[model samples]
Target chain A: MNVVLLDPSEVRADGGASLDGRRAEHVAKVLGKAPGDALAVGVRGGKLGSAQVVSSTKQALELEACVFEREPAPKRPITLVLALPRPPVFRRLLQHVTALGIERIVLLHTRRVEKSYWMSPSLEPAAIDTQLQLGLEQAVDTVAPDIERARGFKAFAEDRLPELAAGARVLVAHPGPFGPCPVDVPGPVVLLVGPEGGFIPYEIERLTEAGAQGVSLGPRILRVETATLALLGRLGG
Target chain B: MNVVLLDPSEVRADGGASLDGRRAEHVAKVLGKAPGDALAVGVRGGKLGSAQVVSSTKQALELEACVFEREPAPKRPITLVLALPRPPVFRRLLQHVTALGIERIVLLHTRRVEKSYWMSPSLEPAAIDTQLQLGLEQAVDTVAPDIERARGFKAFAEDRLPELAAGARVLVAHPGPFGPCPVDVPGPVVLLVGPEGGFIPYEIERLTEAGAQGVSLGPRILRVETATLALLGRLGG
Candidate 1:
């Protein structure tokens, strides 16, 4: 873990935090932290700071957090609307997008997406939280990303997408004669990426009519996770 | 598999090829190819073409390879010099870089790299080939990337790096006061990335002295794989 994160409930009124379970084990074993050593710490939805270890044992660990400047990580201006990837890929994309500082994610349904993917346990709130937490920890950020699911492609494109992308430029990543994915795009963007076989022609036309412009990522086909990262990076995330 | 790849040994003298095992299963079960159905195929280090399924059975499959085109995927002009990542990360990275069309990879030893990482079975030629094949299949590329290992950081930095990076812009990915990585650069580049904890100051100094200019990817810390993809994408890979 790049940073140790604690929830508000875990901290005492005196600014001291008692860490147990996974946190304690990580601090004791993986980090090899000792009393008096300062570790990078952050409160969920709060400030980032350092915590001095007060005492440590196999059972529990204690820390006295000294709040410092409240500087958050760079915010990603892009809102990702992605066709829900397969379960294995979904897990990595969650961690990757979070680490890259994507503020919001919309798990979209497209024609090529398998219906079974929506039933995977990886979409559970707790499982997603765990992956996002790892990403937040990696980026040393306190704010968690907002995630939502859209089960109907047409309804999402014709209804919800227009609202979500009202003030943002909407771009759909597709492989074709469309303009190349722009680099260092300024301001907010709502990026839509499709499933493995890509969006059906009807779905693409619907999204295009909904104000999403198609963009290509050159000739080689990249996996959904890689393509997402590549687009985010190109947009200066 | 997006593309079925056949090595020269698999192709008969008359340009007919027999497939079995994994390739056969992928063609039959996954892609559901039948007689007279044409699938995208490529010969290793050769032309991209279409292979018509001539026959299919549970035990084996047959195809008539029509070498139609010499078009390979767009080439990635960047050569990657990366510290050996952890086993799982290494496997994914190999696949990712190959999919992104990176043709050369040099696995370097650095201060933060664990000694055991060098001993991973994932580094074996056969294992590496498997991962690269998966990537080529995903991208529909026929050529496999060249991979090398450098055991001594100092020696490699002082000796081989200068020669390998000759005539190419040498950019090192470091999280510091360096300028943001360049976008859409025209020409070949040799990109260096560090291990998990990152390269020490001494290693950075050595690389800088050896003609590598450090570049940043903004504030948030990204995993090595993410950073690599981000930089490559920004560079118009």
Candidate 2:
């Protein structure tokens, strides 16, 4: 773990706080923390602090944490408008985007998206949260990306695209004949990535008309998850 | 497996050819091939063929094969020069590049590359070959990418690059002040990507002087593997 993240509710009534269960196990085994070891800790939506381990056991550990400074927000402002992918890929994509500290994510539906993907057990809120948490941990950041779901491309383009694109640089990833995607564009960007088969011509037209510029990643086709991570990495860099 | 790839020896063999061990297990269990099932197969340097399963068992299987036609070479010619990554990531990157039908891969050494990484057990030739085979199978291509090791950057850039870039477009991926990476660039390309911390300024300068154009995937810093795949996807597309 890059940084240890704690939930606000985890703090005990006393000044001393105990980390139990998986977190405790991670600390004891993976981190190999002993009594009096200083651990980097952050409270969700709160400030970061150095926690002094007071006692340790196989199942739980206690720490004395002092409130410190708040973690900084992400450097770049990024919002992803992605068509939902298969469950396994979605899980990896979520963690990767989170690690890169993206500001927001909008999971939209497209014609090519399989209906069964939406109903996957992996899409559960708790599971999604876990993936985001992993991303935050990887980047040593405290902010969690805001994730929203959209049911249809038409509705999202007609209703939500205007609002989302009002002040952001919008780019849509399609496999057609478009110029190279620009690197290091200034200001916030709203990136749209289609499902496996890619955005249909009509969908591309609608997004383009709604202020999204069609961009190409290159010639060879990439899997949905690979494309998402590549776009995020390229755009975020 | 998207395609079945066989070594040159396997192809030149006469009747009663046996596929033992893992290949046998995959054919019998995973692919559910029984006696007389027709399977698409390709010999490493020979021809694509349709093979009929003669006998099947968990541990071994035999096939009667007939040569058909050679699998065509990949359309876009691209070579990847990457600073080796961590073991797991390196394995995945190999498969990914293979899936995209890259022609060559040169694993180079860079300052940021951990010395311990070179000693990784995963770097064994057998292990590397397995990963490459997996990629070849996924792309349904018969040609195997030539995998080579470059000891150092200066030597490779000064001695080897001239011949490597004889008539190819050479692009170096850097997250600096470069414009978007070009898509649909015709002709052969030698894409260079740095390790985790990226190539040092001097390295970038040297590469640029050596006829490599600096290209950016955008502002976001991507992991080495991600950057490689992204560039391949965009360039190949």
Indicate which candidate wins on lDDT.
Answer: 1
TM-score to true structure, per model: 0.98, 0.67
Misplaced by over 4 Å in model 2 are: A12-15, A73-75, B1-88, B99-144, B149-237
Q: Looking at model 1, what is the TM-score of chain A? A: 0.96
lDDT of 1: 0.88
- lDDT tens per residue, model 2, B9-68: 665456336678878888878789888888877787556667788888889878786555
Candidate 2: give its CA RMSD in angstroms. Answer: 6.8
The CAPRI-style docking tier of model 2 reads incorrect
* Model 1 per-residue lDDT tens digits across residues A78-98: 899999999999999898888
* Superposition error at A230 for model 2 (Å): 2.2
Model 2 misses residue B70 by how many Å?
13
DockQ of each: 0.80, 0.17
Please compute the TM-score of chain B alone for each predicted structure, in the order given.
Answer: 0.97, 0.94
